[model samples]
Target: MESSKIVKALSTVMDPNTGQDLITANMVLHLKVDAPNVSFTLQLPKLDADYKQQLNFACQEAILEVYPEANVHVHMQNPAATAAAGQGSGGPKTNNPLPHVRNIIAVASGKGGVGKSTVAVNLALALQELGGTVGLLDADVYGPSAPTMLGLQGQKPKVERVYGKPKIKPLFAYGMPVMSTGFVVEPEQAVVLRGPRLAGIIRQFFEETIWPPLDYLVVDLPPGTGDVQLTLVQTVPVTGAVLVTTPQEVALADAVKAMNMFFLDSVNVPVLGVVENMSYFTPAELPDNKYYLFGKGGGKTLAKKSQSMLLGEIPLVQSIREGGDEGKPAFVNKEDQVTREAWMKVAKNVARQVAIRNELLPETRRVEMK
Candidate 1:
């Protein structure tokens, strides 16, 4: 019995979680064939007894159909643990809510009305354009812009049962998975939640959402630091933050405060870079002229203070505001080459910064409660 034939047979076995074959999902590993004895390790997202038993039985039958008299031994293990072991991160840490995501980028602002959500929606799309599987989490319960910006307003994500456990299926927008409170709650209703209740909703988004494996999960945070920000740092190992601020002195102070929260000893998430939104205004007719309506160099000043790079400057273009209100994002507009390139540059800088952070710094740990 050749190993290729055994692999081919296993490929026919589907993973109910993702509706992909075991081989295609890269769940099967360590195929060791010794005559009539055939054994392999199966990577699983969940290790429920019934689910495991069902998969084990299916694997045996599939192999048996191909090569009769073959004794199949299937060992099941969590892929999350295997991934950590391979990366040399030994021992158990705080339970990570997003183990499948390589990086969690917090696109934050010091205050509102600075185009933070715009930066986030476009940044996620830009990352996808650069060949990375990305997802978006609009963590701003008070004002969830993903629904409108991604043209998914009034649409709710489906809750499906996986392995007898309920999971929230993320809504897709421009080929990226997205989760936002705007999906489930009315604009006015979202503001009624208090303290723990708010945290619980945020926790649900992190733990219950059935997000596909992604290279980056860009989280669009509410302006300023509060329950949502704290919940995020404590929930997952945030790779870094991208602070968005307008090119003005007033916004700089608020941006610094937000950046300082991440810099706290307890929460040591690195500042990837700073994005200056509305850095200048350029009318459609006067494309080459840059009007510094919001002042100059606030992004650079913030970056200098944070000891991070000035990722890029996004001009106050009419199309950006129009796109946001019209349920369409500027990043998806193919004809807008200038806006497209700007977002792509920010995404490229973010990706490079993430690579540098991962190389020079140790993996971030959850902010433990004292």
Candidate 2:
């Protein structure tokens, strides 16, 4: 069988979203031809499981029509891997496009006002506190709260000449690199943006920023499984994702969607675990009391239902709130050992999950069909 025949057949298969053939969109990747056996990979824009299966089947059918005797091996390749394969620089190459960074972790939520940003801020700090060099990217375009939480609001990314190219210098807070849309625009000003514009900004974060060598880069994604979430997963080589939700029925419902996005076959971004933020409330005056403000065990239930680790249950504490507002993440301050430990436990669980993912799965693809 000839690879040219397979390419021509792929060219006939149109993308439902773009109204263009897969070959035209450069989706057909790594095509190989062998007598009685043919193998190829598809790099899709979005990873809808049903759609991928259909596309794979259609491609196989098309190829078989021309080469009836050939056996086909079709694989879905990640965009990150495809991009990494193209770079011809003499520098050390990595499967991840972001070679300077060791690991990229995304923090996501199903809905807003679930303390997602709060969890993201504290978690980044928590990771850094655990002796890892970390960078935090606030991917929440509509609600870029990481700057305020990280105490880097109103700060701007500086441009420097690196290797004869202009590179964005990430702002540092509490000894860790930080970037956010808040840095680009005024805090109170509403960003009137659409999907493409939002995606462009996210792309800029990875490509433009001259990030130093680091252990981890924690991305704070906007709430919901919208453009920002898709853009982050598709563009960056994310190691894993952390789903944040409150112990409430409504929040858990949305959290389910967010978690499943990472679990999708095309994306396959391993959910490091689920974090139950504001799991319970502990009054400052009465430290011994526990209040189920948003109901109980929702995080644990969600984790169990999702078959993911319950990273940690963070309580609704006044100090945690105060610390975020004051540009001091509670985890960074060891004064309140209880709150510090709570956040620290989550951080450790995240690290453990990342380590497990690297050891077992290694690459982005977590599971495969037999």
Candidate 3:
């Protein structure tokens, strides 16, 4: 009978593709209760032009089970319009509006399951540890895993008025603010987004989310150099990118594609460097022994071939994965030398590259057009 309990329960209902629940997906909006007379609105993103009726029926069925006698309503809207409406006034109405964020660094991978999101989460946390205001944007629309990785699966962004306009207040973890598309949809709903729709969602992540003054905003892009990646590169003035790869030939090939995507004429974001994740596995008993589980130096070789720096090599450790799953990033584990040192190396190298890029690059206003 407790409204909070019901809300909490509903938040656990995750969308299958994104691994994020409906409440965090922003699907369940405007919940109200007058004693037992409860009321709420469910906003479902229109995934297909022909599935309006199907979506409506699905929403109705989903709501009735939880709120038996409660009044419920479902609405369908274009994803672009929905995203635009979320961004408040005084914010940039243009395609790219996050002007305050000094550096936009995309943490990308050529393929999935190479610990891309893990690299992104730790890198952002490591940057925050270095005393800068950091924000993490989970732009992996297909599989928005930041919510679970950051331990914010059940949290909802609070709404606030900025200049009389509604703004989405990003959720925080260990002082870093974060926003994810996973924060907006149900698990069962398909994320069947086309190129234009994907672009609109990324645009909304910048415009709608109320990101405070930040020195760096690390974007955790979806794996692959696909439509979503292309859209973000074209739309956001990405200052640089950090390519992540496992020590494997297949992963290295894909990582190369990811790097080349940035070099494309349409998407000219600078390639900051490369990070080699799970570079080696070290057992606690024999700390000195290095086991190349995925093959050694693939990332280093790739970086050398591309004429980019090999930022750092992170060892495979159980705690790194555990920490990510538990919402406490391994970078914060100062007591654990392996985890701490590994992340610190990666963080320092990334920071140094960012500094060098800022100093050597032309002023934002004076940079020559392609």
For lDDT, the strongest prediction is: 1
Estimate the lDDT of model 2: 0.81
Per-residue lDDT of 207 in model 2: 70
Candidate with better TM-score, 1 vs 3: 1
Lowest lDDT block of 10, candidate 2: 88-97
lDDT of predicted model 3: 0.75
Q: Each model's C-alpha lDDT?
A: 0.88, 0.81, 0.75
Query: Is candidate 1 or 2 superior in TM-score?
Result: 1
Across residues 84-192, which tens digit of lDDT does each residue of candidate 3 receive?
Answer: 5688653222323554577888999999988889889889988888887899999988888888888888678887653334567788888888998777776456799
All candidates' TM-scores? 0.85, 0.73, 0.71
Clashing pairs in 3: 14-187, 15-186, 15-187, 16-187, 24-183, 25-183, 25-184, 25-185, 26-184
Residue range with the least summed lDDT across 10 consecutive positions in model 3: 361-370
Model 1: lowest-lDDT 10 consecutive positions: 90-99
User: Residue 84 error for model 1, in Å?
Assistant: 9.7
